[model samples]
Every structure is written in structure tokens, then in C-alpha cells.
Target: MTLGLPDHLVEPILSRALARASHWFALTCLAGALLSALSLGLTYEAGLLWMAVLSVLAMAALLVTLSLRPTVVLTIAYLLVGTGGTYLYTTDLLGLPDVFPASNMFLAALPKLALIMVGGAGSGALTGVLWSTAGFVLAETVTVIAAAEAEVTYLPDGFTISACLFLVAVLLLAGTARRPHRAAQSAIHRAVHADQSRLLRQDLDLRALDLNQDTTLNELIALSRARAGPLTENLSGSIRAALHRLRGTDWLTDADAHRVSHSPGADAWLTSEVYLAIERCRDRGLVVDVIGDRSALGRLDPVVDRELGLAVQQCLINVILHAGIVSAEVDIGGDGGIFSVMVMDAGRGFTESETGADRLGLRQAVRRRIKRLGGSVTVLTRPDAGTSVLLSVPAAAPAAAPDGQGTR
Candidate 1:
């Protein structure tokens, strides 16, 4: 579900956008192509073949995304190739050094940024940082060249100034154009995926609406505030993440939370509020099999209890709606002072968004919860490959005390 070329072109442009209209690759590609066609006299047979080849390849890549499955991998591969092709094409006309490197910059920058936003930091920081710097440097060089050209004596100063200014203006325009024109945020008529997201949101709203409303916001907040003390049990990260999201969107201020509520017993506090969360999911017909203990032994850690609950619920909702999944499995357990929750579904797993920005439903919901709790999530999903989500949180107390610290 997509709009038209007018809108579709914005996908990559929006990817590398900066604060004050910064990304220049898209503009460079545009101006380069136009100038090349005009200056080359459009007469070289070999050049004509290159043009045809480029057009065919680009179209074929995009076509596969529309007419096939596995859009994530295809999109990533196509974008890399297309970026490289744009650099090569621009180089053929403008002769830039290391065009592939420049294209690789575009290929890396946006997706990497987006990946971080949605919990892909599982890849580690150093690699992500190096790649980001390389992309930005290459992108900047390609863009700045237009404004840095030498003055031409044959051309009038005004004309040269005007031409340079025009070039700057175009780069600026292209630079500004690279904002988040996310597929998740597009005109309904043109959006290839709006309905899918809309459905997922609807499910969440419906569920939230059905919850108990008589509970006080302060009570919920107190429930979320992590206890500071020498404790024997603790909540995990996923539960804490869910709590933060629950407060941010649902609670607003404590006043907003007054109506909705959750009260964790001792068992839930020790095992992870995730245990009870799975029960809620099962009540909604979302669980294929629930395997976990719901009883515990201590005060519930505020952060983990709330977030892990919400994350679990969101995961279930995502599968029910998008995974093409009929059944799922849930496991909540602890190992080495770490409370973990694993959800597996026979549905197709997470697909990297075609444009990079997380979609409105699954990614945003999960990430908001995960990040707020100082936790993380991972998705190993492919078209028809099934989906698996593993969430872990620090436990309240270790089964075996460290050396010389057996007594707390």
C-alpha cells in the first residue's frame, strides 16, 4: 500500500534528514542526473545503455518489494545497490572520488539510526558509531562540493554567483527534504501499511479500555516506583519497560492513572510481573500455551513489573494482528539472578521497515517500554520464518551469594 511516485521518492530522502534540512545525497543525485542528461547531449549509445540498466535495476528492486515477500532484505539490498548506483551515476557525470563509499554512507546512516531507535543496539556501540561517522562525512562531502566549486571566468560573475547559489539552493532543498516521511506516516490513500497499523492500535485501545478504572493513579505510581533497599526479590527489565510506557501514555499524570490499575503480589514481584501478564494475555485468547509460575516472595519492583507486563501484552497483540500467527508459546523463568521472558510464535517475525522508521504499533510500543526501563528487546523474524522475542531483567536477589558475601 503506497501513494504515488511523488510520495514514494520521499522514503530515502526522509531517512537521512537533519535538524535544519541537512541530507544532500538525494539532491545531488537529482541535479547530477538532470545536468548529465542535458550536458551529455543524450547521444552516447553506451551511456544510453547505462541509463536503461540503472532504470531497470531500480525498478526491478522496487517491484520485488511490491510483488513479492521478504520486503525487508530486498529493500536493504536494493537501497545499498541503488545508493551505490546513484553515486556511480553521479560520478559518471560529475566524477566524484570513491562514489561507492558515498553511496555506502547513505546506505548505512539512516537504517543504523533507525536500528538504534528500535532496539538494534544489540549490535554494539563502537561499530554503530564508526559506520555513522563514515556515512555522515561522505554524505557531507558530496553535498558541499556544489557550493565549493571554483569560479568560471567565462561566465558572468552574477551568473556564476547565481549558478552557485542555485546549486546551493538545490542542495539546501534536497538537504531539507530528508525528513521522516515514514511509511508508517503517510496518506492513507498512498500508504501500503496504514491499515495494518491501525488495526494493531485498535486492539491496544480496546484492551486498555477494558481494564479496571477505579484504581488510584498514586497507587499505580507507587506500584511502579522501584524500592530502594536490601531486597530478596526483584522485577525484570521488560516489566519495568512496560510500566514506564503504561505511565507515559496511559497515566499521563497520576490523575490519568487513577482509573486503570495493577497490584502485584509477592510471587509476581520475584518471578517478574511478566508471569501475571501472560495470564492477562491468555484471558484475551492471545496465548497458545502459557508456561510460568505466578507466585513469588517479595515486594514488586515498580519499573520491571509495569513495563514487562506491557511489553508482553504488546508482543501478543502484534502477533495476533500482524504475524499471520495462529498460536504462540510463552516462558517466564529466572537463571543466574536474571528474570527472562521468551515469546515464540509461528507467525512471520519482525521485518525491518522498508524506509527505516519504526511502525506505529509494534516497534514504537515495544521500544518505548524497553528503553524507559533501561532494558532491550530482540526480534529474529523473516517472511514465513516465525518470530521470537526474548526479554531479560535483573532479578532481585541471586540464588548463590558472591564469595565472602554469603550473608547480606
Candidate 2:
């Protein structure tokens, strides 16, 4: 049986109980005396009647001291009054037989003894109960046996049987006191440990949250955007500059430069696939030299198939970001599981040192994308010269490759 009182929060209650020990004793004594008075009236015992009277008088004495001294003094008064009251009840008043004559029944006043030991909730009462009950039973049994032999007090066997049940009450009180306190303490320990476990779980969740932020998915994406943006811009500008130079040199006629080299159907396909590429490059000032099969790329369903569209998109992004350009050129060719998208340029090229962020936009964003679609991308470049991206992918083709040319 748990006490059901809060253990950690009970200190103040305990201290107050201790502080008012004398009052508690005095009040309990008064209550016991009234009970004894009733017992005396019922049993017609003059001794018990005086015990009741003396107990009531002791209460008056304790009350008198309350006005004359501090509360602690009142407590001391209660203990004094209680002890005196017990003796008076036993000897001068109640004439109650000493159940434990070799021991002291005064020692068995539970609340009084408990207060003296640990301020009214400790081992004193239990000890007193155990000692007194044991001694009473053994001594009374022996005394009654001897009395029967001597023809002393008239206690029939039936009366003796009923009287001995008092031992049961004493045992009950002792057992009750001991069990609940230990149970309460055990409950408190379990509660504290449960709270600690909950705190540990909360700490782990916080650590996981911390781990997920700042250095995870969002951080990587931000870094990718930063690095990829400028590379795309610079490549476009270089291509446009090369275009003006090529036109001024008269190296290619308008027919040579502007002619669509593929079948009109292929030309439409190429336009569809490469339109975003052209727009992206032009926005950043790159010049595109549309060469070879210009109409071939759009033959596949860029509008219907998302993966194909995204692959085409990344190819253009890569041309702008990774291919250092003099003139951006696309050589679209091949058929059925074999297609090539060559983006030719003039500048410094890829190297082993360009890894991670420096290359994720090109490698992760573009090359890997086309490769996933069962296509391949090759980087052909050298320093101060040129670069070309060869993308060979599987697609059903209509005709052969073309050598188309356009300057933009």
C-alpha cells in the first residue's frame, strides 16, 4: 500500500508535523482520555474514570503554556503532559492492569513515542507497538495460566480467547505503518527515473534535428545554385563574342550560316529540343553555331515525355555552364540507341581537380541526366583551344545526320 502522498514535495508537510508535535500529542492524549472515560463508564472501572479526568486536565495545562511560551514550548508541554497523563491513567486513575508489568505501557503511547523519535512518522511507534504487544501476550498468557491454577480473577476460556485478539490490532497498526512509507519511497524513485528517461529521448530528438539542418539537403542545394549560375553565364558571353568575329571574317555566307541542314521534320524536332537551350544561352550573351543535323533532337516527344525533356534541358544548361565557348555549336546525329549531341566551344577544359561543387552542375545536373536516359556525354577539350560535348542517346530516328549551320 502506497502512502499516495508526494514524496519530494512532502518536506514542508513533514517539517510542519514536526513543529506541531506537542500540539498533536496533547490533542491525541485528550482524545484517548475521552475514549478511556467511555471505556470506564461501560466497564464501571473507577481507575479508568480518573485516567480520563487526568488526561483532560493535561490538555488544560498544554493550553495554558501556549499563551505563556512559543509554539515549540507548547510542543514540549504536550509531551510532558502526555507522559504524565499516561502514568496517571495507568496508576492513579484507570487502575488498568499492567499488561506488560516488566515493561512500561507509557512506552507504548504511540503518537508520543513517534514524536520523540522522528517527530511523529518514524520507527518509534512501531517499535513500541511490537515490544509492548509481544511482552503483553507472553506475560498475560503465563499470568492467566498461573491465575487459573490459583483460582484468581474469573476469566473463562471464552473470555480469554476474545481478549487475546487485541494482539491482532497491535500487529495491524505496526504492519500498516511500515508498508506504506517504503512503498511511497519506491514510487518516487520510479517517477524520477521515468522523467530522466523522457529527458534523454528529448535530447536525442534535438540532436537529430540539429543534424538535419545547416549541413544537409538544403545546404547542398544552395551551394549547387551558387556555383552553377556563374559558369553558365560566362560560357554564354564568350560564345556571342566569337559569333561576331566569325561573321566579320566572312568565313561563312548567310546560306552557309543560316541554312537548316536536316529534313524539315528533323528541323522541327531539333527546334523543339534546343529552343530552351538557345533562349538560355542568348539571355547570357552566348552565340550558338547550329551545325550538323539541326532538326533531329525534337523527333522525340519533349512535350509528352518529361525525362526526355529534362535531359534535353540539362544538355543546354551544361553547354552554358561547363563548355567554355568561342562559338556554341550542336552536331546532332545518329539513330536508334545511337545519337550524338556535340556542343563545340573554344577554351580551357575539364580537369581532375574540378570535382564536387566545381563540377556537380555539369556532371550531376547534365551528364548524369542524359546518361540515365541511356545516352552518353563526352567532354572533348584542351586549354586555350576548344571544348565539345558529345551526347549519344537512344532514340528512333527518321533519317541520317546533317551538316547544318546557323550563327546566333
Candidate 3:
């Protein structure tokens, strides 16, 4: 059995799938109209030929927009154009008694197909159904008006009505099925968390074993020296330190305990050079909120860590100097052996082309340093929009020595 999609991904995936299906359906309808017209030798008529050419061009524009930059506004605009084109095409065909009943029905159904596509363009099932309903009302109104002008009997095509109803029903069913979909998503999340917890425990166990081995060796040395005579001050201090380690009393101080308890990955936060940069920014009256998987920073080697820290410092400096905002956010995450850092600020953003060549803060400091370490920097900004700078680097590994040996 296949488990359903995650809760967060369901709507987007559904919308895209529906949009693709609707595009194909509309294309099929358009193709049918063209083929029917051609087979009847009506392609030679000036009025019908002009309508066909314009309709094809309009359809091509709609297809291109849907493929490149699909928006709800553009979808509605295309639907209106399609409805008008369908009415004109149908009116021209109505004057010809030679038109087959199948061709007539197909021509009448074009506007309804366009309206049905509106449903697929929505961000969610409910939204799509509402948009589709509005399009249907508009299309039917236009159809009735066209038939009256032609002085022909107007009968709603059964196929178009059924298609409209089927689309609405599918959307409603999808809306109602959200509860079970969420449950499946929750089950998957729980399973993933359990697996990560198991891996974390194994790693912690290995670290503890190493600490214990070192502590045991120091304790034995102290005890052997003490058997000969009273312990020296250094030996006594060593024994005391080992006892503290064994009891886990000195693992974290009170301040450190609080920090770790409040911050999920305080170990890396407190140890990484990024922490130093944050403190510096804090001193300069910049409020930086650090979040995400901060512990992922621990995977970076010293050289990579230092470079990343400096790059982040430069990003924060730019936010303070140019963004006109006193606050920023730094997020850390990693996936598939790549560590990522994002610095974001909601302030005045500048266009890349507007900046002078002398503005080297970002080009030299942020981008070049990360690039030297085989990393990438991406900057996203526009006038009035916020700025987000992403820095990504490979995870830690031993550096190559001059003699062709790998050294940690």
C-alpha cells in the first residue's frame, strides 16, 4: 500500500497535478475543434479561418504563461479570452447547416473546458472549487448570450455539465480527506524522529566511551602515585577532576546548563566561531536570532568553520550598514553532507545592478571566502523586498598535507 503525501506537500502537489491535467484537457478540446473544422472544409471560410487562427494564437499564449509564470490572475484572464473566443467560434459555425452534431457539441464545450481549468489553478481544493464555480457562471452567461444573438436554440451540453460537476466533486472529496492524510503524515514524522533519536544515542554512547577511557587511565596513574606517598597537589587535582568527570558534575556549568536547555544545539553554538560573530553583532546593537540545526556546524573542520564564520560576520555587517534594519536572523542546517547558513533581514534591499563596482564587501568577503572553500553563495534581494544570503559548504574532512598525506 502507498502512504499518502505529507500534510505540507499535499495541496501543492495536488494543485500542480490538476493544473497539468487541465492543460492537457484544454489542448485536447482545442485540437478537436481544429480537426472538426478542417475535416468539414470550413477552413476556407474567411470568418471561421480568422477565428481559428486567433484562437490558436491565444491558446499558445495561455500555454506559454501556464508553463513559465502561472498565476491566478493570468489563469482567469486566459479563461475570459477563451470564453469570448469560443462564443465567436460557435456563432460562426451555427450559420452553417452542414456542421455535424458532434462538431457543434464540441464547439459549445470549449468555454466550459476553459472554466474547468480555473479550478486547477487554485492554491487549494476549496479555493479551486470557488474559482471554478465563478468561471462556470461567467461561461454559461456568455454562452446563452451568444446563442440568443444567433437566434438558435440553446441547450446545455451534458458532457460539459458532467465535467464541471466531476471537477467540483473531486475537489470536495479531497478537502474532506485531509484528516486521514494528516494522520499518515504524523505517523511518518514520528517514525523519522525515532530513527534520528536512535542514531543520536549511538553517537553519544561512543563519545561517552572515549571520555570514560581517558578518565580511567588518569585515575589509575593518580592511584599508583598515591600508593607510594601522599599525593602531590597536581595528582590530587587530577584525581578530583577525574572524579568530577565520572560523576558528570563538571560536564556543564550552571550558565552552560541553562544555555543548553534553552538552545537545542548549544554545544556547537557555544563552540563554533559563529558564536563569536554573534556576540560581536550583539555588542553593535544588532539582534541576531540563531535557529535551525545549529549542531550541524560541528561537522565543519576548523578551516571551514573559520571561513564560514567570517562570511556570516560580513553578511551581518552588511545588514547593519545597508539594510536599515537592526535585527536579523541566522539559520543553520545541513543535508547530504552539505552545511548551509542563511542570513536574512527584513529591510531595504538593493538591486544587484545598482551597486557600484567599488562595493566589495559582499563580492570579496562573503562570496570569495566561501568560494575558496569549495562552497557557494546565493543572494536574493530586490527593491522593497527583504534580503536573504545563503552560504553552503561541504561537511568536515581531513585536510591534505604537503607530502600527500591526509591530516586532521
Candidate 4:
């Protein structure tokens, strides 16, 4: 059946395709049969022998082609029908008294039409059309040659009408084949769009969760712990600042907002995580004198912002708790490709080697974090001298800078 057969054949794509094609073939065959019967008038000059025999075999082939059987079986059925039809028209193998010479043309075209309409469906609509067209052409040519050899005169009009009817069958099967693909494409598009919308909503929920932890809830806890008398100036300031942030677009992350760059550095101060860290340190009662270009901190990706933010926070904490000074300076600046921050304080500093088992925070939290980000951290100090902890990370260009940090 299959020229390229393996031990156990399995062709799902071919099977489904042929199944669809068979429907078209079946309908077209019915149409061809009806047209032929009406045009020629079912004449049984005594008995219905040839028509009965051919119908049984063609119908059997049609059934086999449409079945969920091996592709080889379908191929074999097509071959048998094609050869049988050609042989019947040319020979006396299935000879009967009721045979009409003109009807031989119909016999010639029927086998080919059946193969294309039935077997071709397994391959696909395009293949069905291609093979069906070829079959019809071959049928017409063979019929003309056989008719001439037998001196059988078929009306030119009858031959033309029969060919056109079979052509309609080919078109019908082709349309059926494309139907499934078009429907599947539409369904896939809908599924993708739905999935995107669901993920967008989930992202917004996560951003809200991060904002609650980062600002609003923390301020609420601080306000709840205030003891006695009127509210302190620092607590009042914190409350007001928290309220301002909540009312504005500050809590919204980049994923929930659209960026249209109208001018360079437009919202640099508001978006700077470095400035935010400095402010947080100030709230904790450390006098942080920030210097240098602050805008360089604006466009960092959220992941980088969080990594760099935590590293700088760890540095400042070390300065406030161990440096024996309540004040420090944070210098933020960058060249076109590298952004840097240095927390400096004139306090009792230690040797770099002193950051051992007892001082794991400096070695692991600060140095290791920046190192993982493909950046470096440097410590410049000796005992009784000022300590400067500088951290640097790669910066994306000004134009394509990230708009805002989102939740990690």
C-alpha cells in the first residue's frame, strides 16, 4: 500500500487529512452519479449488471479511504479502483449485455474522481485538488483514446458537462480541507491574548503587594508604636510623606505604566532608588549628605535597583552603627556606561582583612551581591581614618533606561 512503509505504520496527519477529504469525495461522487444517471437515463436494456458491479466496487473503495485504517490500505484501495475502472472500460472482463458504449466515458472518469475525492483527503485539500485535477485530465484523455479505438461517439456537450461537474467536486473538497486550519488559527490567537491579559493582572497584584510591604504597612506599624504626648516632628513628616506617595503614582511599577520619553531626565529624582535609600537612612536619624549626579540612579532595572539598593543600605548601616559617626556622605554619579555610589564617613575604619567570620555582612551582603551583578565593590580605609565603600554596576543607556523598579 505504502511505498515507504515501515514495520508498523502510523501517520496521524495523513489519516485526519484523508478523513476530511473523503467527505468531499463522497459528496462529489454522489453528485457525479446523480448527474450521470439523469443525463443518460438509467437504461437497463433488460438487466442492471455493469452499473451494479462498478457501484459496489467504487463504493467499497470510498468506504476504505474514509476509514481510520492504515494509509497503505487507502493507497491500495485507490490503486485497485483506478486500474479496475480503466480495465472495465477497455476489456470484456466484466462484460454485460446492458453495456452502452457512451457510458464507458463515465466509467473512465469515475475511478479517477473517486481516488482524488476519497484517498486524496488523507493527504490534504491541496493534494486532493492536485491529484483530482490530474485524475480528471487522465480520465478525459484515456476516454477519448478508448472511445476512438472502439468507434464510440460521445456527444461533445455531454463530455464537457461531465468534466465540469467533477471539477466542482474538486473545489468543494479543497474548501473543506482549509476549514479546520482557519478555525484552529482563530482559537490559538484567542488563547494567547487571554493568557497575556491574565498575566498582566497578576503582575499588577504583585506590584500592589510589594508597595504595601515597602511603604504603607511599614509606616502604619511605626505610627502604631508612637508613645505619649503630641506626635513627633519626624513621625509626622513620615506620615505625610507616606500619604503623598500613596496618593501619587509612586506605588505603580513600570509594568503597570506606559513610558513615553518626552525629555531626558524628566522624572529622575522621583525614580531614583539611590535617593530613596538616602531618605530611608535619614529617617533612621543618620545625617546623609548626598553629593554628585543623582540622575544616574534613575534608569536602573528593578532587579539591579534592588540589588544595588540593598548593598548600599548594608554599607550605610555599617557606617551608622560602627563608624562612631551619625553623619555620612553618599556620592552618586556615572559615566555613560557605569553607575557608582560611595558611602563615606570620617570614623574609626578597619582593615579590609578584618571583615572575617564576625563581620560576614560586609563581606557577603555588600561585596558578594555587587560581584554577582558583574560589578565590583572597593573598600578604602585604615584604622582611625575615614572609610569609603564604593559600589558600581553596569548602566543601560539613557534612552533605553528602565522607567521604574517593579517587585523582584
Candidate 5:
């Protein structure tokens, strides 16, 4: 029913289509006036003819400007200039109000048609009706004044009156229909929000399970390696931390807790896609030095964000299991429309050929996920040298604010 376009696009598309149609209609009226004048041999009034020509040109310029910019002020200006032009052109063609009926009233109707177009330029149906009504009143007032100046009896054009009434009826009907459409849209949004919330809860449960299992196993291994004598200071500290983590209800790690204290908006970053991976690594006792613009990660699509985050988690997991070091660096940056994250570890690296097919961490999790999202992964490593895995994806452009400003 939406023609494969998003709901938000329908209104703007309709507005633009109406505006273009109105522009063409106005231009067609102007052309008809010019042709009518020529056919009637009105070239004898050289000054009036030239004035009509200039008015036509000015109206054309205003119409084009209105189409391009489309502000309320510009719309008002277009209506004023277009009304004046129609009056001038009509007087030029008909000469006097007495000759209006003799010319089939086409010349007199030009002003009304120009006025009706104001409705088409409006942002919505109700707004269009208000603008069109104002334009109709102004055009009628001008017509009456011009008729009085000529000392002839003036009568309202029935066609113009009927057209205005028809437009009002149509707009009112559209306004009524819009209420139900908005209600439907709200229902759809609520459904989508509920679904997203459910998915988030499931993801959290999985993270909590992984964290609990990893902490318990690591702590048990430490206890098994202890001697018969009293526990070492490091061993005691590790055991206490493990117990606190197991007993604690809050899922936030040390860094997340510190960020929440200083910045109220830190929740957005803390719960961000890639930060989950960083939090997991920190929980496992790996020192992750995150650098560059962290906000850039938020500009990615949800699927890309999730996949990239999982890839980062796997890379860090590899470091903890195989890399002989306990520290790593994750550099996040964006350049030339590409969002990049580089995970580097100063641990003993291995050759690509030496990696077994069963080791799916790099091949399946990291590289494959990034590749599926139209991104690329680069690995630079050698025997005994540090490993660097760079993941890059197409970065989405930041959305603009409603008031024509850039949003943070």
C-alpha cells in the first residue's frame, strides 16, 4: 500500500508532487494568456503588452523560487506577486470589466487559479486550505476594486467560488482521514518498540550467563594452582573480586560505573553495541585501552553495530586465550565514509597458514561478519610480533536535526 516506500516519505513525496503540478498549472495559464493576447491582436497597446510580459516573467521567477525554497514567507511573497501579475495581465487582455463576459471569462479566472495554487504549495491539507482561502479573499478583493475603478457592476465568478468550496471539502476529508492513519502508525511503533525490548532482554541474559561462567571457571583455576601455604596477595585479590562479581546484582563494570558517575548521558555509550565487548574483556581482567572517537560507533546501523561488536568480542577473547599478554588497544575512527576499529595486542602472533580450520574465531566470527556487512578486515601479524586486526565498514551519515542543524 505504501508503494515500497517508508511511511515518513509519503507526505513529503505527496507535497512535492502537488507543488510540481501547481507550478506546471500556473505556467500553463501564463502561456495561455500570452497566446490569447497575441490571437486577439492586443499588440496595439504596446505599453500594456510589455507590462504583461514583465509580469509573466516575474511570476515565473517567483514560482520557481517558491518551488526551490518553500518557506512560509516565500509562499506569501509568491501569492502576493502572482496575484498582482494576474490582475495586470487580465486588465491588459480584457481592457475593461465590461469585456469580461465577451472573452469567455478566462482572463478574469486567471487570478482565481493563481490563488488556488497557494493551497497546493502548503505543507499539509489544513494548512493548504487556510493559505488558499487567504489567497482567494485577496484575489476577490483586488477584482472588486478593479471593477469599481472602471465604474462597472462586479459579480463573483461562480467557477472560482465553486472551486474554493470544493478545495475546502477535499482538505477537510483528508484531515479526517489523517487521524486514523496517525493512530495506526502509533500502534506500529509501539509493536516495534516491544519487539526491540524483548531482543535486548535476551541479549542481556546471554551476556550475564557468559560472564558468570567465565568468572567462576577462572577463579576455580586460580584456587587449584594455590600452594598449601596462605594464598598470595594477587590470589586473594582475584578471589575476592570474583566473589564480588558473582554476588553483585548490577551488570555494570568498573569503567562503566565511573562513566555513569561523571556523565548522565554515559548510559547511551555504556549500553552501545561495541561497549558490551569491551565490558566483557574488562571483566575477564584484560586492560582494554580504547582510543579515538567512541561516538562514531553509534552512527552505524543496528545490525552492523551488533556484528562488529561480536567480532571485537571474539578478537579480545583470542587475546585472552592465546596471546601471552593481558592488554590490548581498540582504536575507533571514521574516514572517507568508512568506520574503522583496529584491535591490537602486543602478544605472540601466529602465521595465517598455521591457523587450523577448527579455529573459527578469526575466519567465521570476525572476518566473515564484517564481510557480510560490506566491510573488510585486515590482519597484520608475524611470529613473535604483535597482532593488529582492523575492521572497517561503511559509516552512515549523521542525521540532521529538525531545525536544520547538526545533531550530536
Candidate 6:
């Protein structure tokens, strides 16, 4: 069971949620600052005034940190340092009197304000909630001690209401941060089911059509042309092979039939197997423009290189044969442990639904080959839109013996 929101729908929902949380944090910081200023105005005492000034400075620091969009490490560091600085200023290095009029009131709100400013910093909801909980505990404990020594209660001045609101706001922000990941999982489930449905549709519509045109019908035509005599052993074997091909999904696994080769130009540099694959496509009169980091392909293992080459060759062939264009481009790059190559063609494209059973080049040659190499293939195309085939393989080639032999 899953929500079937389209990708465009899901993305905007998550983005707006994040934007809302950011704005919420900023609004909370401004509110806390105003409240702290109000507390200072009510007391008009010198010691308490200095503490309020320090609290305002701390809030400014927090607002600056937020504007910079600090990473998790920096966010945690700022929160700790800001809270520690506030603690130091409140006690005046453990030398100040607790009876300084607004001391408890000023200290109580500062820590919670700092936490509210950064409650949305990390990557997940649970982490933010934990940080908020820790901050609340520390703030409450410090405020209680200061208020008890001053012979006043901390809960009477709207502190309890403010604390509850802060906690609730932090929870809401965390929930917003978490919703997108859950929605993304649901999106993946929907996509897998959609692919399954497309595969079934292709099987139903084109399975018999392919078998009839290329196998059964051809065999019958051959039989009609033959003299009235016993079938030759070779003809009998051919018919049997065609029958076997029609009965099974061999069309999706037969790579040899889809293999392409090219003659390398005398002036060309054979930097990698992908280069070799490009040469093969060029030999077939397809115009291919190469770009990006062409060097990464040279670092692949022999087996990985061959598989990647075959997949690239298949993509180029499709662009030449069916893309309604004579030219294509191959862009290569590496990210972390994955090496990626994108073969793009600005030509008339077709949807996934058009991948009939007879169109086995993409399924068997491009996708299955990359999968065998522990890689993935993604196709983006639609009617009148250009096609881009993103092929990604492991950056670090599999370990082998020193003499270029498999260790196993």
C-alpha cells in the first residue's frame, strides 16, 4: 500500500514543508528576542540590563548562523557554544548574585530561544527532537535553580506556555523534515509497480505479434517454398531454434545479436573501451560528440570495461536507428564510487509504453549488461522530447590478481 502522488506533486509538498520550517524557526527567534527585551524593560536594574544585552547578542549570533545554513557539525557546535556562553554570562563566571531581579527570567528564555533557532538544523526529525529535549531540560533546570534562590516562581511569567509552544513547534518542524523521505519511498514503490504493469502490457500486445512475424510466419513461408520432400536436418534444426526463441524471453537476453563494432580512426585516441564503443558507432555513420571526463573510463577493469562498452554501444545504436536524429552526445563523469556516462540525443523520443517485446535492444543489451556489471541504467524520454540514457557503474573496478587474472 502506498500514496500515488506524481513526482512533481511530491517535490513541491516537501519543499514547501522545509521552507515553512525555516520560516517558523526565524519567527520563533524574533519572538523570543522581543520577549527578552520586554523582560529587560520591566526590570531596569543594571546587572539584569547587562545580562539582557548579552542575551540579545547571543540571539544575533544564532540568527547569523541560521542565515549561513550551517551543516550538522557546525550547527551542533554553534548551539553548544551559544548555550555555554549564555550560562557563563548569567552567572558572571559563577560570581554574580541570583537576586539580580530579572536574572531567572532572562536565563530561562535564552536557552529555549537558542534551541528553537536550531531545532531544524540536522538531516532528520528524531535528531532534532533529541536536541530540543536536551536543550529544554538544561534550560528548565537552570531557570528553576535561579528562580528558587530569588524567592520567585519561574512558571508564572508565561514561561510554561512559551516552553510548551516551543516544544510543539520543534516537533512540527521535525515532522516536516521527515515527510519527504517517507513520500520518496512510496514514490519508488509506485514506480516499480508501474514498470511491472508496462512490462505486462508489452508482453500482451507484442509477444504474439513478434512470434508471428519473425518466427512462426517465417517458418511457414520457408516450408511453403520447399519441395514436397522430407525436411533437411539443418532446416529442421533452424525451425527448432526459431521455435525455442519464440517460446522463451531470449530476446531480452541475447546480446550477441545486438553487438556493434567500429573501426578506430588512425588519428583517434583509444583512451578506453567506451572510446572503442564510440569508434564502432562512428563507423556506422552515427555522429557522436564526446564530452566531460573521458579519463575515468580508462581506469576500469577489463570485464567492467567490456560490459560498459556493450551498454554504451547499444545506446548509441538506438539513437542512430530510432531517435530520428543523426547526431548524439556522450558525457562522462565520476561521483563518489560511481562512474556515470550519459548518452543523450535531441530527437523524437518515445515513452516507456512503446518498448514493445520486439524492442529487446534496450532491455537485453543496455540494461541487462549494466545490471550484470552491478550497475544501473535510467532512461528519460517522451514524445517529442530528447532521450538521455544514464549509465552508472562502480568507480573502483573489482579486485583481481596482479597478473590481470581473476582471484577466484
Name the top TM-score candidate.
3
* Order by TM-score, highest first: 3, 5, 6, 4, 1, 2
Each model's lDDT: 0.45, 0.47, 0.71, 0.60, 0.72, 0.63
Kindly list the per-residue Cα lDDT of model 2 for residues 1-408, writing each as its tens digit: 222443322433443343355345435545665565556656665544555475656555654455244354454555455445444443332133433332123322322232232123222334333333442343334434434433335232332233224433433343443434545454654565467778977875665465445234454454455654455654455445544543342333466434424357555654564655554444344556666655555555453223444454565555555554424666667566565666676644556255467556556655656655555677766665666667666664232212211110
Between which residue pairs do clashes occur in model 4? Answer: 17-121, 18-121, 18-122, 21-121
TM-score of 1: 0.30
Please identify model 1 stretches exceeding 4 Å from their true place: 1-276, 292-300, 353-358, 397-408
Clashing pairs in 5: none
TM-score between model 5 and native: 0.43
lDDT of 1 by residue, 164-222 (tens): 23433443444345445433333433233447668867876665654323333443564
Give candidate 3 regions above 4 Å deviation.
1-5, 41-49, 98-104, 196-408
User: Model 4, poorest ten-residue lDDT window?
Assistant: 1-10
Candidate 3, pairs of clashing residues: none
Q: What lDDT tens digits, residue by residue, belong to model 4 across residues 296-389?
A: 7776766677778878888888886678676899898888788889999998898888666888778877887777666778899999998999
lDDT of 3 by residue, 1-408 (tens): 233444444556777777677667767776766665454435545455457446645764675576456687787777777777676666665545544333326566764576565677776788878877876777677667766766667777777777788888887776546655455554654465567779977876776787778897768966865657766888889888888887663444575445545454567677898877876665455779988987788788887788788889999988877786778999999998899999999988999888989889899888777777777899999987989999988886443232323222
Please state the error at residue 91 of candidate 6 in Å.
7.2
lDDT of 5 by residue, 159-263 (tens): 678767876676556444444454454355445556777897787678788877889889998789878898799999998998897776457656544554645
- Those runs of model 2 whose alpha carbons end farther than 4 Å from true positions after fitting are 1-267, 303-326, 397-408
lDDT for predicted candidate 4 compared with the true structure: 0.60
Off-target runs (Cα >4 Å) in candidate 6 are 1-43, 85-111, 148-151, 154-408
Per-residue lDDT value at 207 in model 4: 74
TM-score of each: 0.30, 0.30, 0.49, 0.33, 0.43, 0.37
Give the worst 10-residue stretch by lDDT in candidate 6: 259-268
